[model samples]
Target chain A: MNEKMSSRTLRTLPREKAFYFFTSIGNYTGESATSLKEFTDKISEVNVKSLEFHLYRGDFEKWTAETLEDQKLAREIENLRNQNYSGTALKEQLYNILSKYYEKIISKF
Target chain B: MKFKDNTVALDATDLRILNALQENARQTYTAIGKSLGIAHSTVYDRIKRMERHGIIKEYTAVIDAQKAGAKNIIAIMTIFTDPKESDKVAEKLCEAPQILEVYTSLSEELLIIAKVVAENQESLHEFIASSVAPLPGVLRIRTSMITKKFKETRFSIANNPKQLAFIKEKSNK
Candidate 1:
């Protein structure tokens, strides 16, 4: 019973995931692409994966740890991957569980 | 005119509980009771009664727009449509993914608000140019970004205090 209560406590707790990126690169910036490519390549070199990016329209896009030509773009992708690597998968699994719980909660009303 | 059979009256405690609940639905009954200096059981009873009356319909989490990676934008569109096409236009608006909330207000006010999470300003411009303005019912669209959420509350437990039951009775009719 103690174990059940502990698990219930864990389940009831709220958590938030936040992400940030430096996508403010400017045009006519000399060697910007090369610099960005180098940075993103370094992030990808670390072997991270499983990141997902959400678009403005509630659409989900996957971010693999693979290197891109532009370092800046690559870092943005890697940032998403690093944050999501396992936590995002866990979040999805959790939502599936909680959706069932919400179904029950609503039915009671 | 006969009053609608489904309409019911809410008391003072009921109104207070509702006003508080709208701000934060997850607030504990004990805390709510402490705020009102009532017993926890009284708060629970009032909430239960409110539920039965369909006054308290649902509890929702109000996620911060920036935290969710989406920025809120308010848009007003005046559609020159015949009454017959209103249904189709409303249906189309409902299905649009960018639209977070939509409402039909007084005849002068018809609003459709959308929240888009883009990487930069260019993407936001792209979304407006490509997706929103092209909808069927859209005659003219004006968009504005929300700098801050000043105040938002959905359901209130208390009856509007200053307006006595006379106003409530007339509005309910």
Candidate 2:
């Protein structure tokens, strides 16, 4: 329950004050992202903000299922899709979920 | 009839021709004429008129800089110069081969966007320090490196619907 709320919070938070998270992602990562899979893979190396932005824009379900090949993560991401959240709010929600996922993966080692 | 800016008015047929040429400059007048349902001679005459009016500049090829081994670091520099010496500073900046575009902004700062090709970052730093930093009236220089380019386009006639309609209406008459 707490994890769900935190994921929602990650989706909503803004990354930087200089520009919108989407614009910042393009500037930093290069705008060669033609597909959701490419966008997700490229941004994984840079800041998580870009990934958060894509997730907020409702790309996570496809990216997780197709690119990441994580059906569990896809199902988790699907719950947050189309909830009428603003761009910043959606990013914050995504950030929370991604952070937890990383922590869980790291703890196993 | 004259355009709003008092420029030579282009009719609908002229606009259609311009739009087609913009898409592919190498396209033949016969092809353009066929597409627009106009005579080839009419297409040729309209293009000539547009050229005379300075509406159509030189047709150019867009090259991929990365593939050509001309990939370089691009920087947008806002140069603060003495208010009276702004013009002189801009002139000097334009003379530098590394500088691509120069413009004077509404403010006192002189904006210079340049590309520098070098073996490494150190050489680029040295080039800027020796060539750009020492210019007269160069009070301050702030540069932001362009990491990525999303879209760069030449003249886009297709995007201007209002102008297209105005030109089309004139052609109808």
Candidate 3:
């Protein structure tokens, strides 16, 4: 994947496809991020445990790639996961990547 | 960066930043920078990197349980599980939202100590009788309802040995 996503890929996704946060299996954190910016923002302040759980389970990359049709971000998250990042460390890296994509999304409108 | 050991390449500045955040997490990055005589952006970057390294966990409000009305009734429950099913039982306990914290300690048998909360005595009893008691491999459960609390302490993130280890070894190969 290149550094930038296509215009269509930057658009907001449907509400039902929003990424939900969970602390553990069957434990919801009462937060869902519907767009790139929202994902970036929630990823920063959401429970670290929730972030770690989803990351290890490959939820983030799958949601981004399949629902959002963002192969670029999906691969980025996959790279981070393969690197063995966990907990808050993974959150920080994921936040940085999402922030960059968020800037691209807002600048188009 | 890490050296020969897996230890982080943290410096005095990193230590000072941690001290500032540990003292007061709500303080702004600029405030921390001013106190440390460094640029606020540097402080921001350092903190972000440390978080990526899993050195800093999260900022949370430490509330008085009884006063907050959030988790008023706290109980300490101990479960003795069959040695073979220790991890499985502990993982099952963790799946429940009521269990706040879980720790394992060595005793005559494998002991799982869990801190849980409920709204009232009836709910607490139901949670135990229905949710806890039915778990497979659980030998017995001992629960103690706290009448009062004397002292409590914050859960420091520094003690977490689960910090993200660098994949340097894998990368080298």
Candidates in order have lDDT scores of: 0.44, 0.60, 0.75
lDDT per residue for candidate 1 within A1-109, as digits (tens), equals 2444323322321111101111121111011111222323332322112112222111122211121112333344334434533444534432343344334433443
- lDDT tens digits, residues B3-69, model 2? 7785877667778788889888999989988877789999999998888888898898888988998
Model 3 interface DockQ: 0.01
Each candidate structure's TM-score, on Cα atoms with residue i matched to residue i, is 0.43, 0.53, 0.51
The candidate that wins on lDDT is 3
Poorest 10 consecutive residues of model 2 chain A by lDDT?
A12-21
What's the C-alpha lDDT at position A73 in model 1? 31
lDDT by residue (B1-173, candidate 1, tens digit) is 11399766765566667766876789999999897677999999988877877777888777676688765454333333334445665666677675555555336545433344444555554554345444444444444444556886553433455534433453355
**Candidate 2 lDDT over residue span A51-105, tens digit each:** 5555565555764565445566677777766564445565566556666665564
Off by over 4 Å in 2: A1-109, B1-6, B108-120, B159-161, B164-173
Backbone clashes in model 3, listed as residue pairs: A89-B52
Please give me the DockQ of candidate 2 compared with the native complex: 0.01
Give the candidate order by descending lDDT. 3, 2, 1
